[model samples]
Target: MKLAMKYVILYVNDFEQSMRFYRDILGLPVKMEAGTYVEFDTGATTLSINTRESVNELLGLGLTADVPAASSFEVGFVVEDVAAVIEELRGQQVPIVREPVTKPWGQTVAYITDPDGHFIEICTAVG
Candidate 1:
């Protein structure tokens, strides 16, 4: 079987705040917005945001009373300066899960959880 990842949907509590983070702060290019859904162009893949209930229903996970605090997957993005990114996020008063730190994989990584508590990693690979 051949499978390709066309989209990554994130569950967000506040749509506008999440959209602002993904669009303005993260700098992902917005493709379209319809009601509660917003799509972004993420180079080879697409990023989307929708309500938790809708996502759960689509995944066949039954109806969930509330969205989980965190996602099972860690979404990563390469960055030039993980530290700078952390600083910028801090300046904006964004919640920081883990401060900029070097990982065992030789990457300067910074981790943060989105409004819905999905983990996001910003890292710079060390050669």
Candidate 2:
């Protein structure tokens, strides 16, 4: 089967707080929003956020009670300058998991945690 579109859904404990963080703080354009869901248009793939309650109801399971560890995975974004972006995020009082550092493979990366403690990596390729 072929995929027509792709999306990453993040189940958040607080819908409104996640929405504000992605839309206002990260500055992602809203694709659609409802009471318990919000989708951001990220050009190629969609990034969606949903309330844990909504997901639990949909799956008929207690997944909300089994929140994964923060460092299990991370959402990444490619930026022109990891250092500059990190500085901006710091100014906004965003929690920084790690300061920007250049990797041996010629890339700079920084890590930050979202409201729900999800890892977010801001990185740029080095020349």
Candidate 3:
């Protein structure tokens, strides 16, 4: 079986803020934008942001805009230098959930949480 991940959807409170953060700060290029939705091209995958209420209405659920704890789900990015990325993120005032640490698997990683509390892991494999 061949499986591939296509996109990741983030339910956000303010689409504009999230869009700016992802596009301007994080440097992801915008692919599409509608009234309350924006999509960014992240190499092979896409990152989409939608209003919380819109998501709930589309899914027919009662999902709220309350950001959950950091342990919910993590987005990992393979970086050339995890430390450098972490430093840049810090300079941008992005919340750093965890400082850079070397894992037992011989990888260096740092964790950051987005405005909605979603975890993002910046990592570099030991060579």
Per-model TM-score, in order, reads: 0.82, 0.90, 0.88
Tens-digit per-residue lDDT, 18-106, candidate 1: 89888887888989998778999987888899865666666765544364646678888888989988898888777898898887878
Error of 2 at 23 (Å): 0.4
Q: State the weakest 10-residue window (summed lDDT) of model 1.
A: 61-70
Which candidate, 1 or 2, has the higher TM-score? 2
Residues 43-103, candidate 3: write the lDDT tens digits. Answer: 7988888888887877876767665633588888788889899999999999998999999
- Model 2 misses residue 127 by how many Å? 7.1
Task: Please state every model's RMSD to the true fold in angstroms.
Answer: 2.5, 2.0, 1.9
By TM-score rank, best first, the candidates go 2, 3, 1
Q: What clash count does candidate 1 reach?
A: 0
In candidate 2, stretches whose alpha carbon ends up further than 4 angstroms from where it belongs are 1-5
Cα lDDT of candidate 3 equals 0.83
